[model samples]
Target chain A: MMAADEQQLILRVKEGDHEAYRVLVGRHMKHAYNIAYGFLIDHDDAEDIAQESFVRIYESIQSFRGEASFNTWLYRIVTNLSLNKLRQRKNTNHRITNLPHQSAMNIISPPDDTSYQDVKPIIERALHALPTLQRAVVILRHLNGLSTKQVSEILRCSEGTIKTHLHRGMKKMKTQLTEIKDEVI
Target chain B: MSAHKQIQSQFYDYIQGGLKSDEHSIIDTHLASCTMCRCKLEELKRFIESPVFSPELPSDKLPPEYWNNFALEVEQKIRTYEIEKREYSLSLWDWLNSLFIFHKRQIIAVSSALTIVCMAITGWLLYVPTLVDEKIALPEISSSQFMEIDQKVGEYLHKSKTLLVGISNLDLEEKSPIDVTAEKKASRNLVQEARYLKNQPLDIRSARLIGDLERIQIELATIKDDAAIPRIEMLREGIHRGNLLFKIRMAESMYEMPRLMNVNNIYSGDRK
Candidate 1:
């Protein structure tokens, strides 16, 4: 949450006070990095995304009417930029991973002893399997625990679209994981 | 619609829990009696909870080093962007200064030349009206100077007669001491002058004289070397038949004598 005083700092930044911008960035840098990291799951990429998002925010701050607080606007920027980078990465290397043929097929069962580490690859595969919008919605709603309404706001999509993506994403993961769980049992 | 497809389609909306009361109750009653939809709703919960299935957003903090210079780095990027944006904009004064510095010698030379040309044009504009006024005043003053004009015309006619008499006496067939080529060229020039003089608004007798002079000059211009004897004989016969030489002498006397007598009378009256 942005402090009430942060709005004053935003005003100063709009007035060309660099120190005010620095303070605003200092306050929100951690939150921005976490959101980007949650999406990209990379430390260096997250940091880069955070920095770029701040630069974009600074450049377009004059047009920032405060209806959606500076944070949601910043979230939208970092999330959108990270999503683009993910799409570019997806396009470059479109091949599936080197799991066993059976695991790759559908079951996605963790090899022998099931642990979070063993399951991590399966979860990541399922998450990336989703279409880009669905993946964003799932990450924002399920992973980040944002409400469907908040996810819709971040994605600038209708609540119905967000809900549809969220439900479909979860359902696919459930079907896969249930099959794996049936194998483990 | 199949019962299964209807349940599957509304599964997303139903899971998000925003369905209206009537719609919710309808789906709820169907789910209560329908084993497949009930099982599907149960699967939705189990999947959201499973570690093997759910996406982890990795909210763990990044390393301390990552945040250390983070704000400074962003501000530096912002400052650099601002610098680049400013460097790209050239104000009018800066543009003019650059232009002046780039072509200093050419600009100075062109400006100096233009200044001199402008001064010349201004002088011409001012001086030209005076020249015009003088020209206008001149024709009016020279309006009463017709006696002088008539005398000048008489003198011009007297000069033209000398050229005419020379050509008529030069019997080209005999080809004597007269330089015939030079005399022919002179006569050609005299023809051009006579043509100009013929157009002058003058007494009918003078116009007729000029007209006769031009025709003789043209016949002289076309004189064939082999046919020279016959052409010259022909031309002289034509002139004698017209009695043009006698008419010219008589008109010159009549025109010049009156102007001279008038001037003499004026001088005499002034003396008395």
Candidate 2:
């Protein structure tokens, strides 16, 4: 939530208010975890990055000079930390295994929702297959529901570039999901 | 039809609500008439509207207890981090305290005498320097003055590049931190030089490059002897993000090319 209320929490946080810090962490932790999850499909890695991101922000909160909104700053940190994790994974030649399909389907509260169950892994794999920038644009733009302008700010690129990446990323996912559509039709 | 091509391009913008009303109507009309376009739009919508892109995390995926304790866990982590930092600083003091316990009186007497001698010398030195320093006037910087500054900046950039490359090429498996001591020392000197050049009258381009250089140089200079891999990786990321080495090389070439041309012209004149 890009509410002005965070400004007060941030000010209190800066003044060493532990209650304010707790409030701030509670408010943004899910968003941070979700963004990290968007980059890293693994829940454990996402949780780790999300927790570490908040810790980094707490340590360097003095440097957070309200230049951009707090959410934007948090998003940038989550995004960078997630990318670093991915890079580390790559350097170590580690592979993240996908959850078993039946178990993944079981996690959905309404197991009767067959469409989402069928397409969830497919969509996730397509997203994972994207180039880093395109995947980031799609995740921030679509998954996080940030505006293109916000995505551009977070990615530090022009809006045109964001649009191009978004367009390309969606097209790829759409192609991958075409089988589901044909089955439905 | 060319209309179909144009309409396809707007599908993303249409779904995003980013198109103007007129543009939106054009796509709507095209989709209504063309079954192919309608199906394509439907396909995009299906993918875009999938629960995978939802902002809300699927509740069942994570236990409720996890959310309940997330904030507390973050706070606990932060507390642990602060304690570790405090202990790191406290260790330095503890070392000094132990030394003082062993040689308390001798240390006190020596420190007291040294302070008195230092204060006396400081008083004499401050008194003498004011008179000698007051007569010196700041001179206007000529082009050649900045040219010299540019040369020094170029040298600084070269050295910085070498140090960064050295850091980059270091064996990641090396457990020892002392290997970076030389690089850190060189960065410290570059930081001093950067500060000096920053105060000088230089062109905007030179000034900006130096500003970026100063940031990374400070990071490099302050790298702890016990720095972890992540710390060094962060420094490398900063260099990559700013494209610092590339910019430095471009800046050096911009400054060097002119001087090289001038030297060439002088040699040609002498030959003539």
Candidate 3:
């Protein structure tokens, strides 16, 4: 939701207007989905996280003082849920083979013609390869055009920490994509 | 750091234009002269600027209906969530008000029975011990042998009380078998002595007390090194149940105070 619109909707919801809450959810749901998509690469998982984030926003709206913009607050919930899902996936300790993301390749198949345009699927493979936080930092900064300070607020970290993560992430992306010739061939 | 590494470090900041002009100029100068660093920066830049980087749309598409019904779905979810939460946590007044609304007779039956049972338990505990106390008075000692026997029994009871109190006071934090070895030995021995005392010819109070103390001694003897806290709690519950601890203390003092007065009376008669 936009900052001013969300604040008014929030005041109405707090005053027990359920319709105002529905308006807020409808307005912000797509941005929530995109934010979730940035962190979690799957479209369905992105929708699930976004929906769950809205549910959380509804449940915990009483504690929302609107000190931070609702836009930032919504993004924070989506990011935290994605990170938690990542941690749970890690704890299961499934062995990760050097296999590529099937979802990434199915959509972005390179043509047989030798062009640097072949780098699309390879970039997809590279993007999904980084750790959860690094992937999130890269996506939020590069795709969404969030500043280091903005990314820091959403991820709940210092600006310096966000920069460190963003750099390490971009550097990893550089390493993996540059080596695409060896992997894709 | 080498010029190459230094330029590499600032490359992201340089691309974002976050660097101060002086720092930006130095990196820009290095990049102009350096082939490898410049190539790395270009590659990184292209990857960040790609369709892969800006996937606000998913690579795979979702249904139009999914977006359309999302708010209504979320609102329905919130409504269901509220209903479920209300069912889980009802305020006392709310639950009672609802109970009266739906099932007044059943509520009255349950509350009335609960009150009666609570009162019965309280009255029994209070009244039974006082009646038992009254019925078990000591015999009048008329001879020196009787007095001597009374004195021996008194000493044994005093020793048993001291041991039981000490065992009760033992901290459960002491975990080693050796830490409780003395208490265990004394308690085991007290069980046998108390059993003999229960069987001896005595007033009803003495017999009842010996029985309680024997049970208590057995309770104490069974406490394993590590299970002291729980077993001590069990012992305390039993002691409290029948006012057993209070009776034992009263019997010990009842025997003691008169005996001290008699000694003084005999001494006065001798001086006369």
Model 1 misplacement above 4 A: A1-6, A17-23, A90-117, A175-185, B1-30, B53-55, B87-272
Worst 10 residues of 1 chain B by lDDT: B263-272
| Ten contiguous residues with the weakest lDDT in model 2 chain A | A96-105
Per-residue alpha-carbon lDDT of model 3 for A1-185, expressed as tens digits?
A: 34676688899998889899888887778777777766555555776788889889989989998788787888889889977876765688732343333463344433442333344446656777888788888777776666677788898888767767777888888788768757667
Compose the digit string of candidate 3's lDDT tens values, residues B1-272: 56676567667777878778998889878888989999988976776566545443442244467667878878777788898788767666688799898998898899899999999999999999898877555444457855655565576576666666665676666555335556666678777777766655667887788887877878777778777677776786776786766787778775562334222221122221
Which number leads on DockQ? 3
Which of the two, 1 or 3, has more DockQ?
3
Candidate 1's DockQ? 0.23
Per-residue C-alpha lDDT of model 1 across residues B6-90, encoded as one tens digit per residue: 6655665576675788978888899889998888887775655555545443433234565668999998888888887887674
- Rank candidates by TM-score, best first: 2, 3, 1
**Candidate 3's C-alpha lDDT?**
0.71
Q: Which residue pairs clash within candidate 2?
A: none
Binned by DockQ into CAPRI classes (incorrect, acceptable, medium, high), candidate 1 is acceptable
Candidate 3: stretches off by over 4 Å: A92-121, B1-10, B16-40, B50-56, B90-272
* Clash pairs detected, candidate 3: none
**Cα lDDT tens digits for candidate 2, B1-272:** 26665577567778889778998888888888899988878877876676754444543366567878888889899999999999989998998999899999999999999999999999999998886666434556677887787777777666666667766776777665545666666677778988998887767987898888788778877877676466778888888888877887888787673343222221122321
For model 1 chain A, where is the 10-residue window of minimal lDDT?
A100-109
Q: Could you tell me the lDDT of residue B72 within candidate 2?
A: 89
**Window of ten residues with lowest summed lDDT in model 2 chain B:** B263-272
